[model samples]
Target: MTANKIELRSVNVTRYITPLREGGSLPALAEADDDFKYVLKFKGAGHGVKALIAELLGGEIARTLGLKVPELVFARLDEAFGRSEGDEEIQDLLKGSQGLNLALHFLSGALTFDPVVTQVDPTLASKIVWLDAYTTNIDRTVKNTNMLIWHKELWLIDHGATFYFHHAWDNWEKAAMSPFPYVKDHVLLPQAALVEEINDEMIALLPDEKLREITNLIPAEWLSWEGTNTNADAIREVYFQFLVQRRNNANNFVKQIQHARETLV
Candidate 1:
């Protein structure tokens, strides 16, 4: 599980295109210095930098497992950004989000994944279900698949909801090893027949060494928030520990997913 250093690209936000109002976090599609459009997640909105941390961790972890995820980048917002915005809400959000933010490369012409029309292979479906269970991601329900079909391939997105335990850090250890009951509502649960079979293989992909590498990618500023007295490295260590504990206890959730799928199908 030894990993090479992760090299996430950084981009400067050049222009704000438009806000994707569908998301509570108010993510925006904007042009970057590279002239490519990206879906920008502001650090000042919703759960603040913690959400970005979850996105970074979740997306990168998925990519490491050989899943399709849009290229993640660190988007820099200058002090003068959003100076001419007419919307007061967006202007304030921009002002608060100045400095570093997180973004995903925009997959142009991608279509929302519809479970009815598109069928995922049992193995891929099982892997996705396993990933959601491992990360404790609760956002990929039927109501919002949080997946898209780009170039006829399933691509995952919107991982800001993962690692909810950190939002209330006191019970993090308890949450880490807990079985994710929410897997019952997963959109891909019906097709995830190999949940148990893939448990060892999937867990093998995320050893403690790789987990440390993923947590190390979180920016220092994103770790310190309004109410936390903990230092950035300490917070990162907590994240690494949580992930390692979760992986060690993967069977707890693998069984849960199998039972849920059995009940569903």
Candidate 2:
């Protein structure tokens, strides 16, 4: 982490405007004391705090690599706001997430990235695919491409679907070394002709220090899992190690993606 690395700002949610109900977790649009509209994902959602952690770490890593990801911040949720909510589910979510939660600075008029309407650059597609492959993200499929396009450019979002291997912590090492065969179905893979080149580029860009720097940015509360009695630091270490090991063993996924691209008709 450099002295000038982006700081994750902390702000209080001033109003819960509306819920984005399309997703299972029910993230909401809220106004922060900073007076910015944000898409806030609650820590207490059914997906749990780990989802928020993934959102921050994954999205931040993309930004560091010059990928377009909206600014993320920590939103402090006050439980008092939950009392006036009519939805039982959202009320429980607000009350449970009464402290820090993950938020993305809302892009007022951004359109969801539509492949039919946009032709992406092969280099950018390959880089985005490399990002997903390295992170084990299965959510970027054609059907549910979790991306947005603002100002005629692509923006990555919704990384809760990445890092699913963490759910089985015991075999995480093996999982980290596992090949990401699903890259074949990535929405951008057809244009990802430069995936191998992108892999080499990212390998040069992400050092162990940089990877650990991103992992350490995750908030402590989000690292603690009461459901699993998981320790915050231990989980953090697991994430750090998984990323470092993933990069060190990049050949596994690099080969998988290249092979997948070769087979694509």
Best model number under lDDT:
1
Candidate 1 lDDT for residue 152: 92
In the range 1-265, model 2's lDDT, one tens digit per residue, is 3524557899999999999996689999999999999999998887788788778878987887779998999999886877998999888889988988989999999998889988999999989998999888989987898999888778998998788887666899998998898888999988988877777778877887788788888888776665677777788899999998998998899889889988988
- lDDT (C-alpha) at residue 117 in model 1: 97
| Clash pairs (backbone) in predicted model 1 | none
Model 2 lDDT, full chain set = 0.87
TM-score of 1: 0.98
Count of backbone collisions in candidate 2: 0
Top-TM-score candidate index: 1
In candidate 1, position 64 carries an lDDT of 84
Reference-based lDDT, each prediction: 0.93, 0.87
What are the per-residue Cα lDDT tens digits for candidate 1 across 63-87?
Answer: 9888999999999999999999999
Q: Candidate 2, which segments miss by more than 4 Å at Cα?
A: 1-3, 227-230
